[model samples]
Target: MVAVLVIMTAGALLGYFLRKQPKIVMINDKLIMLAVFGLLFLMGVAIGSNPTIIQKLPVLGAQALLIAVVGIAGSVVAGSVVYYFFFHKKY
Candidate 1:
């Protein structure tokens, strides 16, 4: 995982440098969206394939949903606080 992350970071830096060259163009949003959906679908399929996991999901679904909601809310609140403090530039 660390190696993968390092490789991805290196690739992103390389892309950023190359993008400063004159001939580059932005990628299409449609392709980006399609790649996102494809990755999400594959993740779902991997998670769905475990029969033992699927069997217990009914009992755990509400707990999972609650955790997910709380996590999302926490991230949004944290992001807003960071932005207000650092990016507002008025202080």
Candidate 2:
């Protein structure tokens, strides 16, 4: 919840600034790449240090991939529904 608030505040600030300079957008691929790489590094460290985790990897890996795919799909659908209800009408 706190993280959501912080992101909302940051997004608001970025939007406000962007209005003043329509040519400039705050979010870009580089930021996304940085975040993705950072998360991957952390996940790698966690997986590397846990012997039990590694041992169970063969069984868990497929399950994890399926869960991740489902979660991503659900999130995308939810986001689209929320945006359609909240913002699409305005545009």
Candidate 3:
């Protein structure tokens, strides 16, 4: 955890110093996307190689879907409440 935070802080400081360089910014964006896709592909491969997960895929899919739906519903309800209270203007 400390190492992760230290690396992240170092990266943030580097990025701050490099903020004026558009070329570096563009390269950084591409690198970030490549890293994300690589991690996702590796994760899929790991999950695919697990037989237990394969067997429970259907149930896991249903649970994931339920959790996602509930999360979205809760976010929408909470956001609406906040907007109504703080940002909405009466006619």
Candidate 4:
């Protein structure tokens, strides 16, 4: 967990410093997409090799779906509130 946090912090700082470079920003998007797909592919491979997780996939999927729905709903509510308070009047 600490390693993950350190890596994330480092990436955030790098992105912040690189924000002024449009070429780097454009390349970052493509690189991020490639990295995400690579990570997903590796995750699929790991899950495919795990017999226990495969057997419990149905339960896990349902829980993941529930969490996703709740997260989306919360985000929408928060976004609407922010828009109303901050952006609605500007428009």
Question: TM-score: which candidate is best?
Answer: 3
Question: Please, what are the lDDT tens digits per residue for candidate 3 over residues 51-79?
Answer: 99999999999999999999999999999
State each model's C-alpha RMSD to the native. 5.6, 8.7, 1.9, 5.3
Q: What is the C-alpha lDDT profile of model 4 across 1-91, one tens digit per residue?
A: 9999999999999999999999999999999999999999999999999999999999999999999999999999999999999889773
What are the clashing pairs of model 3? none
Q: Put the candidates in TM-score order, highest first.
A: 3, 4, 1, 2
If both were scored by lDDT, which would come out higher, candidate 3 or candidate 4? 3
- Least well predicted 10-residue stretch by lDDT in candidate 3: 82-91
Off by over 4 Å in 1: 20-25, 28-31, 68-91
Q: Over the stretch 1-91, how does candidate 2's per-residue lDDT look in tens digits? A: 9999999999888777677663455444467688999999999999999999999998899998999999999999999999999889673
Q: Distance (Å) between predicted and true CA of 78, model 3?
A: 2.5
lDDT of 4 at 57: 97
lDDT agreement of model 2 with the native? 0.86
Residue by residue across 1-91, what tens digits does model 1's lDDT show?
Answer: 9999999999788877877665552453456688999999998998799898899898689898999999999999999999998888883
- In model 1, the clashing pairs are none
Which residues of candidate 3, in runs, are more than 4 Å off? 87-91
Give the winner by TM-score: 2 or 3. 3
Full candidate order by lDDT, most accurate first: 3, 4, 2, 1
Error of 4 at 46 (Å): 0.6
